[model samples]
Structures are given as structure tokens and as C-alpha cells.
Target: MSDKKYLVTGANSKLGKLVISFLLNEYQIKPSQLIATSRNPATLQSLADQGIETRAADYANKDSMVQAFKGVENLLLISMDAVGKRDELHTNAVQAAEEAGVKFIAYTSMPNPDASPVFFAFEHEATEKAIAQSRIPAWKILRNNWYFENLIDFYANVLHTKAWLTASGEGRHAQISRTDLALAAAAALVNSESGKETITLNGPESLTTSEMATLINQVLDISINVVHLSEEALEEQLESFQVPADAIIFATTMDRHLKENKSDGTSEAFEVLTGKKPQLFADWLQENKQSLKAISNA
Candidate 1:
């Protein structure tokens, strides 16, 4: 294997932070060989304190990304939260990696980005294509299923509102904890196999919002009625929570995705990659109940 270093972009993000930890702890990767990049490098104090090199890499500034990627061989391109700007930002980052002579990329993407009807998926599709066209020799497109973490705030909100509201009518999707996804991504980062691969990472079970709500109730020891809404109604509910207009649209479209598609595969892919079984959703929920309760009270 080459002695070139591995790097993570969006280092301060929720997934990025966890992936770094897994790489350092579980993978036993030396801090000297890992770099973390964020637009606001000052916010990466935690990573820096661990002796990992932290650099400024702003997606809006391709030059900055190119500068930050120097000497980096592998990159964990955690998708940014820039709704409308992901394609442009990620394409530039791929180009920047090439410009800086970086070798491989492992991107966290939504399931079926090319065909999924989710509003935010087109950019992922574009970024995937950009990576394929790039000069970088190898890549891994880790198409991550919906994160169970997406519901933490919603569960918290429902704890207060007493209603689990959704527009997805009897839709089901395999969901996994964010920590498992990080472990998978970290494994991909450290894997030195030199070929293009696309892996769809899904949880062990497909679950509807209602089923999830039941699990939530069991976890929190409280009752929450599952209320189905029209997509329009769902948007209104999101607005009432002060969610941004764009995010409201995104949430509804995700419901459509869940209602329409299936078979993203099971946790075996996660186990194969990480050599560990993904934590069961119920188990995860039980463990995180205190945090959910705290959010509810917030």
C-alpha cells in the first residue's frame, strides 16, 4: 500500500466526526496519516486535539479544497447539507481531488440517487457521474439508506405533540444507525483495493413510520398516535415546526421514495464491510432514549 494519507471532508459534520473516530479507534489508523477538512477549520478543534491535521476546505471554494487535499490519497466525501448546491460543490471537490493528485474517494450517497424521486437526489446522481469521469483511479459510492437518526428530532417533536405525523402511506425503508454507517465508511476509507465499487448500505429490517413510532413509544414508555397526512398537510406540519421550505419539500419527497421502492438490501452488506452486525433499531432506540427524551424536553 502507498504511504499516502487518508482525508475526510466536512470534518465537523455529524457523520464526518464519527467516521474519524472509527478510523482512529476501530481501524487503528494513526492520526498522522489522517486529515480532516472543514470550511471552518477553527471548528475542527476536537479533531486537531487528537493530533490529526485539520485544514480549511470550503466546498464553495474549490481552490480551498484543492489546497486541503494535498498529500491525501483517500477521501471520505461526506455529502454536504447544501440542498441545491450539492452537485456543483461535489463536482468541484472531485475535480479538486484530481488536481491535488488524490487517488480514491468514498462518497456517502442516498439510495438509488439516479432513479429515486427524492428532491435532493439529482445532485447525488450528478456527483456520482462526476466521480466516474474524474481522473481519480478508484472510488466507492456508498449509497446509504435513510438514517435512523433522521427521526430523533421528529420523535422528540412528537413526544411533545403526541402525534407521529407522516405523508408516507404504509411505506417502509431499511434504516440504520449513523454510527454503523460511519463504521462502514471508515472501512471503505482504509480498504486499499483498487477498483470502482458501489455498495448500497441498508439496515436489517424495513420499517414503516408507524412501526418506528411503536418502537419509539416502547423506548420512551409513552404513547404517540401515528397520523397519516397528505403531502400538503405534511408540508404544513413541517412549517409549523419552523423547518425551512426547501427541507419541507425534501422530507415529503423522501416519503415518496419510501412508499415506492424496496430491496436496498440488508445489514449483511454492513457486516461484510465492517465485520460487525449493525445494532438492531429497537436496541438502538432503547439505548438512545435519554437523548430523545432530552430533545423532547428541549
Candidate 2:
């Protein structure tokens, strides 16, 4: 592990960038020991400037990833965003990692992929299985909950109607910040602990839609009422809002998962990994108040 490097796939993604930053700034992972890979390696110029090797690795092209993964011992496989294409993309990545003889893997995954109600969660479960069956000596699956930043869409949508629609009923789910998730991921990639593990990184607490609306109300100084919808009604409403066909199923199923407490509860595994408690949603709301305010203004 000391002789090889830690590599992060999808170096250009939002979570990927933050994970790299945490590895560098917080964990002090030296540049010589760090590698960043992206489909467009040119976009990682800043990372290259920092002395971290930037390699071109396309998930669609297994050969590129297998080549880029050479000399890499630890891999942080950021979950890809191309919803419809992630299954094949992740399979390619896992195959490449194994071919490259990567020793350990820390994969970012959705919460409870094995039984998640999210429509596309099976992709993550498949990825986890691939990693487990691979030649890697150790693996960690970081099951990240929904990010606090998801409210960007929720807020934008609700401001137009002044009523937040949900099928989650009174279910409370913890929404973490990307930064906190990054810290936890960096720790998982670089920490001394090894062997197969699945850590659920979560926020400090769970809150219902009404509780979240109250916090948003306090910050944005606007009253946003929570409107409970049946699953069918939620689907119809999401369709009415022009949400894509695939996303409607994703959202509706996610709401069902939430209602069933699949994505709820706070986990301390994060504090164990990073020696710091995860951020509070209320605090995140305060820190990003300006952006949230601007959304309403926009």
C-alpha cells in the first residue's frame, strides 16, 4: 500500500472533486500517493498541477480504465450519475480494477442497496457483489444518504407552488452534506482498517418533510406547507411537472423507501471514521442560506 497510489475515478464529478480535496487537505494524502481519473483528463489539470497524476479513464471504455488503474492500490469509485447507464459503467470499472490488480476498493453507494426501494439501486447491489467477488484483498461500501443539496430542486419546485409535495408521509430521513460524505469516503480509502465493510454515512439527525420545511422557513423566511400525496398522486404530480419518465419512478419508489424507513436513522460510523460528527441539516441550511434565498428570488 505504501509503494502504490490511491486513485479516485470520476475525478471531475462534484462528489469526486470534494473527495479528492478531503484526501489532500484533511487526510494529507501526498500527491505522489494520489491519482485522479476522469473521462476527460484535461478537466483534471488543476489536480495535475498539484502533482497528482491525472489519467484518462472512461467508464464506457474498459481498456482505458484498466490502463489508468495501473499501480493503483486503493480505488474510490464514485457512483456515476448516468442513471440508465450506470450498471454497465460500474461493471466495466470493477472489471478494470480487478484486471489492474487494485488491492482495495471503497465504493460510494446508495443506502441499503440490497433492499432499497430506489428503482436503480440494484445497480449498486450488483457493483457491491462484483467487488466482493473480485481479487481485491479488502473493500468498503460507503452507503451515503441523500445529500442536503437535493433541496435545490425541492426548494425550487416548492417555491413555484408554495406547497411541498411528498409521499414519504411522516418518515424522517437524514440528509448529509457532500462535504461530510467526502470526509468519510477519504477516511475509508486511506484509513488503516481493512477487510469487507459497509458504512452508512449519515447526517446528525433525521427529519420529516415538515421539519425540513420549518427549517427552510426559518432560513428563507417563507412558509412552505408540506402536502402529503399518495404514491399514485405523487407520480401524477411529478409527471405534471415534466419530470422525465425514469425519474418519476425513481422519485416515487424513493419516497416509498423513505416511508418504510429504509433511508432513515443517523449513523455514528462516520464519526468513527473521521473523528468528527456529521454536519446538522439546520447548520447546512444556515451556511447555504444565501443560495437558498437566491433560489426563491430566481
Candidate 3:
């Protein structure tokens, strides 16, 4: 495995970049053994300058995916950022990897894909099914829960409205950071034994919207009320923020799922993989207080 080539698709993404960081800084893997791919290879010039090969692997362009994946022994398939087109894009990419003789894969997926009520989870579930049906020799499913950074959106909204509006009644989310999830992905790709494995990675604790509001008030030293709304009212609230229609629908749907405890799963997979406990949400907020303040100012 040391000599095998590792390729990360969507390498310019937040999660992808962090995965590369752990693979290099933490694992000390040489750049020559890594390939970073994106639709525009030029965006990865920084990684290219670091001696890692940068390739054009467009999800919409099958030929590029096929050529870029050639000779890749292991693949880290970051989910496509294009929400509506993801299932098709992921299917094409997976087929390309199989045709390129890539034997192993590690996929970043949503928690409880098959059952999750989140709109995007449908595509992830489809991709997982595709991988299962394929002939890939080994695979790992890294089912990452929500990210703490998502609260930044809430922070942004609160900065304007001074209130947190949500349809999520009593549900709490186990939100981990992208950095921790990326480390878990890197570990699975570089170190895990060849087999079928699915790791559900989540934050240490679940916190409801009200609890999140309290955290914000404590961190920012400003009182902000959590306004519970019906699903229809939440849509109107999101619309007031000028949120795009599709995003409003997505948010409301996920909020409904959250109300049902869809995002409430917590696991020690991060500790098991990295030999360290995941950071607490409160601690992450404290550490990023400066940034959070900046967001408030923005």
C-alpha cells in the first residue's frame, strides 16, 4: 500500500484539501504518491507546487474521469458539489474508477443514507448502492454527520435578524467539523485493511437549536432568542433572508428530519480512527470565536 497511488477527486473542496493535509502532514505520505483532481486542474496549482500531481477529472466529463483515474490504486471519492446532478456524476465516476483498475475506494457519505430525510442523502444512498453492486475489491464508507461550521449560516442570519428561526422542534444534531471528518477519511484511505467497512463519524454530543443559540449567546456575549416556527413559517423566514428557493426547500426538509432525530447519532469512529476524541461543539466555538465575531461583523 505504501507504493500504491492515492487519488482524491474534488480535491479543491474543503474536505478534500484537509484530507490531503492529514495525508501529508500527519501520515508523511510523499506527494508523488498522491493525485489531486478537480474539474479545473489549475485550481490545484498550490498542491501541484507541493509536488502532488494535479489532474482534470470533471464529473460531467467521463473521458477526463477515465483518464485521470488510470493507474490509481486507491481512490477518495468526495461527493460532488453539484447537488441535483450528484447521483449521475457519482455513478459515472465510480464506473470510470472501476474501468481504470482502481481496486479500492473510500466514499464520503451522509449519516444513515438509506433512511435519512435530508434531500441530499438520496443521492448518497444511490452512490452507496452503486459501489456495493460494483466489483471494487474493497471499500470504506465514511458516513460523516453535520458539520459545526453549518452554524456559521445561523450566525450569519442571527447577525442580521438577532433571532434564530428553525422548524426543528426538539431534535439535536451531532455535528462534527470538516477537519475531523477529513482526518478520518485520510486514515481510512491510507491505513485501513482491504475490506468492506462503514464508519459513522459524528461529534461527541448532540445539541438542539436552542442549545446552539445559548452557545452563541455565551460565545458572542449577546442574547439571541430561538424562534420556533412551523415548516411553512420557516420557509417564509428563509425567504426573508433572500435564500434561494431550492435551498429553502432543502433546509426545511432537513429541519423536518432533525425534528425527527435524524441527525442525532453520535459515534466514537473519530477516536477509533485518529486515536483522539472528537472536539466538542462548544470548544470548537470557543476556539473559533474570533472568526465567529468576524462573521457577526460581516
> How many residue pairs clash (N, CA or C atoms closer than 3 angstroms) in each of the candidate models, in the order given?
0, 0, 0
TM-score of each: 0.92, 0.95, 0.95
Error of 1 at 7 (Å): 0.4
Those runs of model 3 whose alpha carbons end farther than 4 Å from true positions after fitting are: 153-155, 239-243
Residue-by-residue lDDT tens digits, candidate 1, 223-288: 889889988898888899899877787778877787776424577777888888888899998888
Question: On residues 213-239, what C-alpha lDDT tens digit does candidate 2 reach at each position?
Answer: 888888878888888999999999889
Clashes of 1: 0
Model 2 lDDT, full chain set? 0.87
The lowest-lDDT stretch of 10 consecutive residues in candidate 2 is 153-162
lDDT (10s digit) by residue, model 3, range 1-298: 3678999998999889999999999888899999999999999999999999999998888788989999998899999877887888898888888888898999999878888777888899888888888888899988889888876753376744577778999998888988889888899888757598887898888889888889878887777888999999999878997999988878798888788887787667778888877888778889989888777766
Best by lDDT: 2
Better of 1 and 3 by TM-score: 3
Tell how far residue 242 is off in model 3, in angstroms.
Answer: 5.5
Report lDDT (CA) for all predictions.
Answer: 0.85, 0.87, 0.86
* Model 2 stretches with alpha carbons more than 4 Å out: 1-3, 153-155
**How many angstroms is residue 186 displaced in model 1 relative to the true structure, after the best TM-score fit?**
0.5
| Best of the two (1, 2) by lDDT | 2
